[model samples]
Target chain A: MTTAQPLIQARGLVKRFSGFTAVNAIDVAVRAGEAFGFLGPNGAGKSSTMRMIGCVSPPSGGELRILGMDPVRDGPAIRARLGVCPQLDTLDPELTVRENLITYARYFGIPRRVARLRAAELLDFVQLSERADSKVEPLSGGMKRRLTIARALVNEPEIVLLDEPTTGLDPQARHLVWERLFQLKQQGVTLVLTTHYMDEAEQLCDRLVVMDGGRIVAEGSPRVLIEQHSTREVVELRFAGESQEPFVSKLEQLGERVEVLPDRILLYVPDGDAAVVEVTALGLHPLNVLVRRSGLEDVFLHLTGRTLID
Target chain B: MTQLAARRARPGPARVPALAVLQYHLVGYRRTWRGGALSSFLLPTLTVLGFGVGVGAYIDQGVDGVSYLEWIVGGLLASTALQVAIAESTWPVYSSLQWTKIYFAQHAAPLRVADIVAGQLAFVLLRVLTSAAVFLLVTGVLGALRSPWAVLALPVAALLGLAVAAPTFAYAATASSDSWLALLFRFAVIPMTLFAGVFFPVESLPVGLRWLAYATPLWHAVDLSRAATLGTAPVWSVTGHLLYLAAWAAGGWLLAHRALRRRLVV
Candidate 1:
């Protein structure tokens, strides 16, 4: 949490593919022993940024420093301290689970004995020790992701980069992964992850940036971002057999903002209970109503005018 | 935690990272090497028995002062190594890049694109040399090694293997579909093996076709191998063959590095 020195720093970083610009000039910095996240939907250049930080892709322009070293000249040296879990599972399918970690550790020149011990410990950390001898191909999606996470920890890296660590997992699977990552964070391993799941960001990221169209639109803690961009509460109203768009004019001034979605109209207000009372006073008899605290999803929708997952 | 402290207190010394990349493939190969054992030993033995002894019995006057069994034995040895090298370079390299994504995993680690390409070439060399070793053993069992100098063919086969594999590795990395690899085998690898003096002397072909075989890497390999096994190599010009093969290996490595960098490094 010390700002005197950051573990990763980028200034005006850019990435372009052929004629298409994937990441525009943007700046970011992350401190040691903290969890930072890039929150964006697909095609927002989240994975591209992760690749640059991982030292697998050279930045097309601008300056990026990881561990206070240039990426191009010192990629190998930098990567030695990085553990990257790519969006897709790139585990060696032919090798068994334990072999995958042992082999990966060998790439870092870790001695065989140490690699074996670390692989065992990491397997236990990820709770995959019982399946250590199983082939990676037949494992469930959750198991594969856990294995990938465990593989990333083989080097005991200073910073672990996870690109959409829980993209395709079931709810239960994601929670298990989140728990393991939380443990890593508790152990003082800095984690940088990209996820479109707002709940995930809220649960795991101590601080994050919301990216849209390859640009960072906002940066803050999940709670701070939500409070900055949205109200303290949200009131959802759904009128049966109504277009819902017509109610926008009626509900516009009821709160700070009104958002009309396909099935519901959301009112951003300081107090959801007061907003509901005000709505009834206006004689808007709604078929359904729900009041909930605002979250990162509201912040994202407010900034981008699009859902994060969409 | 202790290991983490150890790595932090003293990072490992810098070494050629390609060897680590090579170790990855070799470790995977350990599980699959048994599957290849049957083919590596069986195919060459069959080729020697089917053509060297079965067909050579018909040619009363051996093709070159030696028995046809001995003449074809050396050529088959070189072609076998070339085939093994090209085979290793094609689908396995392609799958590692595309399907299996082993190179992506490696690239995400500390290794560079050049290290990945070099490691793949090294693995191909291991395969070619392994097959060559077994080929040499079979030759010895069949009494094909006429001179003690025949041991030199093993290293010669290694050079030939690199010459063929390096460029194929570049092609595999850049290819969009696996279909093109099938064409490489059918048009390039098969023709070089069958027509590059492995089955018969290139001098017997039509003049236009003779030059084509002379230009092939397999032909140079066969010439060197035949000379080593027969002890009839021209002493003054052997360096020329070695240099030519070296040129192929060096050039192919450069192209593979470029292609792999483009694909993996973005």
Candidate 2:
């Protein structure tokens, strides 16, 4: 690595809400010009961690330094250089789409003329120029999310923090947002994001940490985490049954590991086709069988338990 | 990096942080000011015409040796300021804090909680001042201005605005829902307007109620405002009235600061 200092540094960071510990001690470091991610299920304290990093929530313990300044005291200065897009849309309902950008820019002390030009530029960037004069309440969800993202870029912030950027969008809208975020990454803006979608992590994060129960269970590049936690390939078997538990013991020795779900059985092995052959030799006639490469989803299942997290 | 270079080269002016947040309120008002304008001008005009001039002709000897029309004008000015301040404070402040959550968005920016509160409170004061100015003119046109000191009522009205608006800001920030806000107006604001020397002198009330009125911010504002228009001495010393109003503002600001931080910083 180069001698450049990390943009954000945290050691044993903790956040508590009343008597409950939402975020337990966690360590993290985000370097400049690289995309970092927090991958977790809901209630994993990823948003709490992002809130502390955003300087809106004070840490209950440990140390946090964003841009080499204490977030507790130097919040305004740190926030001046940071842009945040929260999970929910918080756009101003009174103003038009374009006015939202201009007014938000002024919060950074941007001059009105500069603010106006930057707003127009950002509107074009987000492809919301045609709806510049429209009220915020009437925009579609995807449009509003894009506008919020544009608002986050009003100051051309050094770092952009996105908390589940595309959690509730359709596939087309998700791709559009993902594509825009990818372009920002290519432009060398440091991006810190949190998501439950393994595909999102794989698509955008150069490096990431998996959080479970307010703790970082694993941290590495996406490929590295997948490689360390899962096999090269997976064999998925779906039999004609409501539950796949009955076939678990029968297929246990055919692969490195066998996992049974509500509808399917997953076999972790070096070669998925060889595992399927072994399954056939075991006198198991499956209704459906498919071979696929292991992904971050499998890695998360291996790290966390099998019980579903909503 | 190029964007950073361009920003440095531009070398923008030193920005006052509160003014930046206030710009949002101002921009929003540009679209909604028409609705507010109608109420500020029309409320006092109708009250003066129907209640002041139209009804004063029936009071046998008038009030305190002056025409009843001129007698109630100053109190009405104070009342108008209180109404304007509270109107701007309750629903809009609660909306920004909870419903729209625009204040949370502002909190995410490079602004302190003080800046957000001060900026919006300043806008409320502006509303109070402009509405008071219009009220002064409407009453003046209807033969209510008896002395040159009548203009002082504008500043007195703004002070009263801060006295009421700041505390209401705290309530809005901390309230769980608009139902609490409805109860506040029904219990607090309505009672103050009726009992605090706005429609009649507090001295005419029972001793217990009179003392209660004396403790209200509106009573101090009304007394000072009456002295301003009638060229008469206020019931309390000028410094005492000013101090009482200023103390409420300071205390309310502290409460609002705490309330806003609690709501937004979490």
Candidate 3:
């Protein structure tokens, strides 16, 4: 509830497993009622960081505080006030969809009658009320994910930790999940999530950290990151050729920077139309051309030297 | 309850919130209880009919001054508790830890690793008590129960469950594969149940094998339960049997807590 102090604060946080360090010393802070994110590719230690924040995995080094309380000493107290939706569903297969929520609520010591009401409300909120009695085994991946998200809210937690909220869902399912998450944000629930999808981070995060190889590489609002790291517009040139390598040198002087991919050449420029005009004046003909505004994907690519998805 | 309140006041690793975990398991048990109920009732009935009536026809002289039905019935009740306890501790514990990952789910909440382990062990004891109570009732109807002290077998059965479950929970938590459980049942559990003086006197075995049986938790449970049912416990070293069973229960719980912490808290 306090704005001056962050709900979660970590300084030089580290997580080491046996001989390998999954998360190197990193600093992070998440204030109340804001949606924060950790965005990165696989093996980037995003999940490990999320696990540490959820208080399930102990930090091998550094200091962590949740609700201004030490993680090691006040884990249960802190966890009681936090909701965690793990990367996997972890739903009980034997219990019905409703029972999953109710049972999880009971773990937090919610009274039976109150738990029943909350389960019903969450079922409706997740749009799973129709299938409330059905076993979780029959639900689709999207439905299960939504139920997981719903389950996370059962405690009416001060902060919700979502690890890869929508990794495997189809576009429509992902949109529905995003919409519900947006609703939670509108209701002023603090959310910290991890995801590899640039669009998901762009869509949901108020501020995010870009992680790679157990360290924070960059941190900012998506717009600020894009503005700072990438150009305003981009022109993608795909030629009917065996390789895009030769065209990269020819297109270099036309834009601020040129990146060559297997199938296309991207020109980062202040203006897409000017870049396209320059490309045309160079006497190089492209099979197809696309001019678009820059996004977080471009920022990630610009900062990390790799495509966000690949 | 006071311990829980005290933990809530100043929570740490030394004290885990247990009631919440117990409530979670109770909710999970709601749907699965029916299947467990059938086995709890049917296994005892069949064992009594098959081993008590069919096998008892051959032995005119009861083994311990009682009918063969009465002698074996008490042992069967104790073994029933052991079976229920081990069954709950093995596949269900493994499935919760590995397959369903329910333990991880609880770990994400206010519950600690110790709470999850203790709550599950308590649930196993609840199940063992239920099955043993039903088996005791059947034994009574069959005229196998001889003394008023037979009522004490219910709690004794729960103690047996604790003895078996603590160690089995630890093993299941640490096992890497479900196949290991099959091997455990075949080599360890089945052998213990068969030769733990359940069907015949352990004295009939060779001296070395008899001492080996004496070391098992199930043998102690059977010995104590049979004595209680037949009013023969006062004649033996009852304190020693109770102490031995208590040792297994206490030691098993500590080992199980460590194993669960290794698996879930990490």
Per-model TM-score on C-alpha atoms? 0.96, 0.96, 0.95
lDDT of 2 by residue, B172-213 (tens): 888898999899889888999999998888999999999999
Candidates ranked by TM-score, best first?
2, 1, 3
Off by over 4 Å in 2: A1-3, A306-310, B1-14
Question: Model 3's DockQ?
Answer: 0.45
Report the poorest 10 consecutive residues by lDDT, candidate 2 chain B: B5-14
Across residues B156-216, which tens digit of lDDT does each residue of candidate 3 receive? 8988889889999999999999998888889878899999899999989999999899989
lDDT of 2 by residue, A1-310 (tens): 4538899999999999998998899999999999999999999999999999999999999999998999999998889888899999889977999999988988888877777888898889888999999999988889999999999988888899999999999889999899889999999999999999999999999999999989898999999998999999999999986778889998888888887778898999999998888888889999999999999999999888643433
Clashing pairs for model 2 are none
lDDT of 3 by residue, A1-310 (tens): 4589999999999999998988999999999889999998899899988888888788999999989988788888888888899999899987899888877877776765677878888989989999999999989999999999998988888899999999999999999999999999999999999999999999999999999889898999999999888999999999987999988888888888887778888899999998888888999899999999998888877777844434
Instruction: Point to the candidate with the largest lDDT.
Output: 2
Q: What is the lDDT of residue B194 in candidate 3?
A: 90
Query: What TM-score does candidate 2 get on C-alpha atoms?
Result: 0.96
